[model samples]
Target: MKVLVYWAAVVVALALVAAAGGGQVAMAAVRCSPAELSSCASAITTASPPSRLCCRKLREQKPCLCNYLKNPTLGKFVNTPNARKVAAACRTPFPKC
Candidate 1:
């Protein structure tokens, strides 16, 4: 009986870990498009908080931030104070791009 209880607890712990891991994987797979970013840029530049869809795009584009920051033309938009403000408003940490 003791062994059965221990095994049950172990299985429960493993299941919880697997569920959390799957959530992270799902988030990581999210993606964004140029149109999505453009839709949010104006509001972001004006210091308005980004909408839910805009914030979702931002997270989806997280992997591209550094690359975008390296472009002379795009860098201006990504490196602005307004961009940071929007990111903060969305509760998403800005990537160190």
Candidate 2:
């Protein structure tokens, strides 16, 4: 009986850990792929206001901004003044990383 109780407690603890970590996994599944921000390309390169679609994408991609900034190929584009403008226009807080 004691062994069974110990096993049950272990299982419950593992389940709790998995549940807590699942949210991070789900977040990680969505990447900061530059392709995802294609809608904002024009706004980023030009002085035109960002479109609704661009703002939506920017909001969705906010969590990945730091990762994008760290990427050599995407860093230049993501760290640009225009990109920052778009982020400001969209009301998405830019990641400092």
User: Backbone clashes per model, in order?
Assistant: 0, 0
**What's the CA RMSD for each of the models?**
18.0, 17.5
| TM-score of candidate 1 versus the correct structure, residues matched by position | 0.61
Model 2 residue 12 CA deviation in Å = 47
TM-score of 2: 0.68
* Residue-level error in angstroms, candidate 1, position 51: 0.7
Residue 20 error, candidate 1, Å? 38
Residues 52-77 of candidate 1 have per-residue lDDT tens digits of 88887787777656655665545666
Model 2, 21-94: lDDT tens digits are: 42123355664444557677677777579999999988877777776677564576689898889999999988
- Return the clash pairs for model 1, or none: none
Worst ten-residue run, lDDT, model 2? Answer: 17-26
Candidate 1: which stretches are off by over 4 Å?
A: 1-33
